[model samples]
Target: MQAPMTAYKRAWGEASAKLIRKELEKVRQEGDFSEERIAAALRRLGCGRDHGVHLGHGFYSVHTGVACVSGRVAKDEVTSKVHGAYAEPQPGTGPCVENRGGH
Candidate 1:
């Protein structure tokens, strides 16, 4: 049997999809837009604002759906972080990686 989907997850997925579609449309509409400008536009589309979507410890996602963007962080911030508004991680120690049973 398949597992049921949670309301939060469903909503998040929908919103994320919408954001992506909107971004694509924007690109098609305006060819010269930069990544930062596109991200800022997404944030304005009910996604929230920049600086609120931190991925934790200064890491952030430049898009949506990849990370949870609720509570202190706004939806737009989450989107911006995913879109490359933040600095890249240092070489050695990367973000915490989850270990599965494999390998």
Candidate 2:
């Protein structure tokens, strides 16, 4: 027998979400949200150069292969979540994309 496609999608989504959360926490602790820092963090978490794009003004959009996780970066505040702007992420994906939604 074969597993359903939804199951695979959900698994990928969850993985993507987890990665985003993990990196975001580290970013928060570091207290730096510069473009370089954010991009490096996302890259460390498996985001390719093309996948992570800066939307300017501290806003960013990143696609982590299976799901999209994005948010804003500021000195006082930093936010990150999974937002399926480019494409609908599978169920269980987290939440933000600058151009799409969840800013």
What TM-score would every model get versus the actual structure?
0.35, 0.57
Give the candidate number with the greatest TM-score.
Answer: 2
Q: For residues 1-103, what per-residue lDDT tens digits would candidate 2 score against the true structure?
A: 1123356555675677676667766776788766677778777866755664444466666655555556666656556665344443323332223223343
Query: What are the lDDT scores of the predictions, listed in order?
Result: 0.38, 0.57
How would you encode candidate 1's per-residue C-alpha lDDT over 18-77 as one tens digit per residue?
565555455445653444554555466645333333233323233243333221123333
RMSD of 1: 10.9
Candidate 2 has a TM-score of 0.57
Question: Model 1 residue 58 lDDT?
Answer: 25
lDDT, model 2, position 26: 78
Worst 10 residues of 1 by lDDT: 78-87
